[model samples]
Target: VAAPARRGRALTAAVVVAALVLFAVGGGAGFALTRALAGASLLPPPSAGAPSLPAITDEAPARVTTASAATANGEQGAEFTIEVGADWTSFLEQRANRGLAPSTVVHLVAPTGGYEVSVQRFADYYPRHSVEDYLSLVRSRWPKGQYFGEATDVTDPLDPAAPEPPVQFSYRTVEKATELGRAADAGGRDLRRSRYSRVLPRGADLWVVEVVFPTEQEEMGRSRLFDTIAGTFAVVG
Candidate 1:
C-alpha cells in the first residue's frame, strides 16, 4: 500500500536520537534510518528546524525516576534517572483532550535499557484501517526488517479469534533490536513541512518512541505533537 509509516515531524534534530530508538523498535518504523542521511525533511525551507527525540537523561524540572534500564537500550548499558511532572496526574489530565484519560507508559528493557514513547489520546483507528493492512505495508516497505512478516490479518473483533483491543492495538517488548534514529538537516528548516534525518555513530543503536491517536494523528502522525514527547529523552531515568 504505502511506505512504512515513519514519523516525519520529529523533522527536528530528533533524527539521530529517534533513529537510535527505532533500532529497538525492530519493525518498519525502524527503517526511518535507512531513508535519510542528513535525515528527511518533508516540509518547505527557510524557517524549518530538524529532528529531536525526547531526552534520555534527567533534569531539574522533573525529579529523576531512576530509569531501570539505565542508559540506552543495551546489555550493560549506561543508566540515567528521569523525573516526570511532579503532579503527573494533574499535569497529564490537563493536557489530554476532554473525556480522554491521560496515559503515560514507560516501556523499560531489563538489565540493559529501553526507551519510553508515551501517548495521550489513544484510539482504535484499526477499526477502519486494521493492523493487518498496516503490517502488510510495513513488511512490503521494509522487507529486511526483523518483525515485518505476512501474518494473517488479525480477525475482526467480532470473530472469536481476535485478541482484546481488537485487531487495532498492540505493544512491543524491550528487545536487543536497537536500530537507528536522526535527522538530515538542510540549513534553514521549515517547521510546517520538514522531515528530519541523520547518520549514527559506529556501534551505536537506535530507538523510537511513537505517539498516536491525536486529532491529527493520521495527518500529523508522530509529528503532530512531538514537542511534548520529543524533549523527554533526557528527562526520565
Candidate 2:
C-alpha cells in the first residue's frame, strides 16, 4: 500500500483534520502558530458546516521541519510511535522524557512561535477523571476550563471564552469509535477514516503512525502497537 499523507506521522488526513479544526476554532494566534509548525498540510479550511476555525498557515511563509523517531514516549512504555519531517525537531527534543502512557499519542507544533503539544491516550477513554481530561485541563492559553471528571479540551491553543468552540466534544459524545486491527504500511501512505483530518500551512504534508493489529488478536494487536511506539523512539534535531 502507499504511504499515508501525513505531514506529521502516518496519521490520515481525516484524523489530522478533525484534530486540527477542533483546536483551531478555540485557539487564535496559538492555533495559527501551531499549524505552521506542523508543516503546510495542517492549513486546511475547517469543516464547512461546523463552527469555523481560521486557516492562517495557508498564507504564512515559513520553513517547516520533518523527522524520523523511534518512540514518542522515551523508553518507558508506549503502544505507538510517530515521526514527521524536520519541522518537528524542537518539539521532540524538548519533551522526550515526560511521563507518557502505553497508548499515548504525542503531537508537537512548531517551537519558534509558542508551540502547543497535543496528546491522546489509547487505554484511557472519556470522563474528566481519565488521563485525556487531566492533560487538557491544564492551563495553557487561558485559565483551564472549569469542568472536571469529563473529557474536555481535545483541542489546543484553546480560548477559555469564545463563541466558536475549538475542541471537539469528546469522542464519547460526537461519534462512535471503531477499534482498528493491526496493519502495516512501510511507506505510510494516505488514508481516510471517520476519525479526523487536518489542513497544513502550505507545501507541507501530514501523516499518523497508528498501532494496528488483526481483528482476531484484539488485545495482542493493541499491545504490539504500544511496544512498537515505546521501543522505536528517537529525538531528531
Candidate 3:
C-alpha cells in the first residue's frame, strides 16, 4: 500500500509541473503580441506642417537704372533729339534694355505717368506703298470696335517741297481680354491711344515716331508732350 501511494503522488506532482509550464509559455506569447500591437498605436503619424518649398513668384523685382540721352543717341548713324517733360528725371526713364534694333535710337517709358515714346529709323524699302496704304495696314490689326481716326498730313519742316506732306495717323483701341469678352467685363477702362508719324524728309532715312498711352482720359497731356518732342526731333545726317 505505501509503494502505490508513493507512485500516485509522483504522477500528481508531474501533472501539476506540466500544466505550469504550458501556462507560462502561453502567457509569454500573449504578452509579446500585446506589446507589438500597443507599440504600433503609440507611434506618432507622419507630420503635415513641414516647411513649404520656394516658388517662382518669390523672385525679386527688377533693378531700376538712370539713362542718359548721350548714351541713347550714341548709335552709329541714327542720332536724334527728343523733348522731355519738366521734372522729367523724376517721372520718366529711358528703357536701355528694351528689345529694339540698333536703328531704334530712343525709347522712353513712364508707367506712373502712363505713356511710352519710341523713335525708330527704317530704310525706304516700301517706296511703292503710299503713306495711306501703310496706315491702313496698321489700322487693320486693331480689334473690333476700336476706333481708328482718319490720317492727317503732318507738316515736315525738314522737307517743304515734297509732293505730299509726311502723314500722321491717330487711333484709339480698348484692350480686349479675348475675342468674345466685353471690355467692361474684363476690368477697369484700359483704353489705349496711339500716334504714329511717318517722317519723310527730302533725302533722309525714313523714320517713325510713336507715342502711346494706356488711358485716353489724359490724352491732352500726352498729346502736348509728344508734339513738343516731335517738333524738336532732328536727324543727325
User: Pick by TM-score: which candidate is best?
Assistant: 3
Model 2, CA-based lDDT: 0.32
TM-score of each: 0.23, 0.21, 0.49
Better of 1 and 3 by TM-score: 3
lDDT of 2 at 19: 88
> Which 10-residue window in model 1 sums to the lowest lDDT?
193-202
Candidate 2 lDDT over 14-77, as tens digits, reads 6888888977776876776777887655557654332222222322333333333324435422
Give the winner by lDDT: 3
Collision count for each candidate, in order: 76, 68, 0
> What's the best-to-worst order under TM-score?
3, 1, 2
> Candidate 1's residue-wise lDDT over 173-210, tens digit each?
21121233223343333222111111111112212233
Candidate 3: segments with Cα more than 4 A from true spot: 1-76, 85-105, 111-113, 161-164, 177-187, 194-198, 202-204
Model 2 TM-score on a 0 to 1 scale: 0.21
- lDDT for residue 118 in candidate 1, whole number 0-100: 36
